[model samples]
Target: MRELTESETRVLFEKLSKYIGRNITDLIDRPDEPFCFRLQKDRVYYVSEKLAKLASNVSRDNLLSLGVCMGKFTKSGKFNLHITALDILAQYALWLKPSGEMSYLYGNHVLKAHIQKMSEDCPQHQGVIICSANDQPMGFAVSARAAVECKTLEPTAIVGYHQADLGEYLRGEETLA
Candidate 1:
């Protein structure tokens, strides 16, 4: 994947700000701050943190995954590209292995915790966590039901399957494009 030029980055940020109805001037004054000030305060920091991680990866999958994670976690309710938060968290766990702070189980647990937190804090976003936890078959069934309801109210991209496949597909790939 081609690295985004400085101008492209600026344009992309502007577009995102506009799409979310955030004032560009406010964001310029505090670039480190989140775009979702009151609508979904928790999501602002969550998204900013995810973007910081994506900035280090050269793969398109990684970038897309980051975008999906942001959209899912924030429950933006628009399908762009389906990327699962579990996948990103799992990758972070692997990267943090050297620090001995996280194992696969630990990572999975953290993912579950985050999902649960999101569900509790944002009832409207509860389906996002449910859908991403669908690897558990039973969870998937429940999520599917929730998703059906969510879909009637608003469109949400399904991401669990896509995220599950990304790790395998990118394993030996030479380029990101």
Candidate 2:
């Protein structure tokens, strides 16, 4: 995966910093120095002493698992899922390994084009899917089942910028099931 350009990195940091204001201190467990930040419920939570202590003990492998698990849990029972991660290209391997039902729309072109087409094709049902920048379709069968089980047929849309790490495609499978 390509490293983010300096400008892109700066943009990411700026956005993160804006959300970390005031709570910046909470991210550091030790008063003298600190490392790492926590994300919770679409919000970045500054780690307090207690939380930091727990984070410190977590291993790298465990941390990766935790991240995937968190992503899965956050997605719970949604009929249609849309994820848009800035670092998707770099983190695809670790991010898309969880077990669950989901539909990941990756890449700006595919996502945008698909959404536009879906919009033009199905205009009646709207506001069904919520988009995010950090979701990936992992399990093909599971996602198909979820999509079929979903009561609402409202079209959903997502926007991403990379195509390499989007995982498997299960579009028509849902309708067949």
Candidate 3:
């Protein structure tokens, strides 16, 4: 594990804080000369160094940076959330029913009927993270309607579209050409 310097940690925290919409650096981490987090077997979750790198880029470029590995959840059950640090911080989340989970994971948009719940994170048409009922972050999505208006939407209405669903591994079925 690489121990980050004070400035490095501060820079990382600031960048993430802005994207996540929360000042929660200390909640998940501690400030030290060399700040680092070791994922313990007993721990349920932890963010990866890749997140910091991505955040740095977003911070430097002032854009929405998409990362491949944001964070992970341990089956050990130390925590209940299996989401990327970025999504967790963004505050907008959508919980989908089992049927929706299948469709979303298979690269389809979630309809209102398939949705189990939605978080009051961002305004309508804003970006939101879609998760399974288990609280596992599945992918990024854009809210089809405002937070308050989402509930009034029809069951078959489009709730959000899957932008990233960690389907790269499942996409490796191509044979050498």
Candidate 4:
């Protein structure tokens, strides 16, 4: 495990900021305990300072993982946010209709007809947290159309592209363990 380099930090934050926006600061400057990001096997872990310090005592070979597995960096250096980071992104998310929830969970793109509502300022291609009507975080997606555009679009028009979803937890159970 090691610290993220300057370039890696930039890449990671750029991907995260797309979904959570300025809330990234709240992750760093927390009221309870300070948390930090650490890299282990290309996967970024969001760990508390105390736990990270304790984890430092263990050798790299034996430490399988640290805290929450935020995501991983590809060989090409692109960061992919994992479903595990949903808790943090849930704060500012796009709410979907109940009809859309199942489709999204099945890894299908969100259709305009399924959208209950979205943020007023949501723009096309922006990363957004996808939630159910009950406000449950379902996954993450990239908006396919701007808020205004959706109003004039057909019901079957794509509104969001699935990036990651909770269904992955069950589908990739073997790999997750």
Model 1 residue runs over 4 Å out of place are: 1-26, 31-114, 119-172
| lDDT for predicted candidate 1 compared with the true structure | 0.29
lDDT-based ranking, best first?
A: 4, 3, 2, 1
Residue 20 in model 1: lDDT: 29
Model 1: which residue pairs collide?
A: none
**Where is model 2 more than 4 Å wrong at Cα?**
1-12, 15-49, 54-108, 116-160, 163-177
Give the candidate number with the greatest TM-score.
Answer: 4
| Residues forming the 10-long window of minimal summed lDDT in candidate 4 | 168-177
* Candidate 3 residue pairs that clash: 20-89, 113-155
Which one is best on lDDT?
4
TM-score between candidate 1 and the true structure? 0.21
Candidate 2 C-alpha lDDT tens digits along 58-119: 66445432222112113432222223222211221212211111334322222222322111
Residue 91 lDDT in model 3? 48
The list of candidate 3 runs beyond 4 A from truth reads: 1-19, 23-92, 175-177
- Candidate 3, poorest ten consecutive residues by summed lDDT: 34-43
Q: After superposition, how far is residue 123 of candidate 3 from its true place, in Å?
A: 0.8
Per-prediction backbone clash count: 0, 6, 2, 0
What are the RMSD figures for all models against the true structure?
A: 13.7, 15.2, 11.6, 1.9
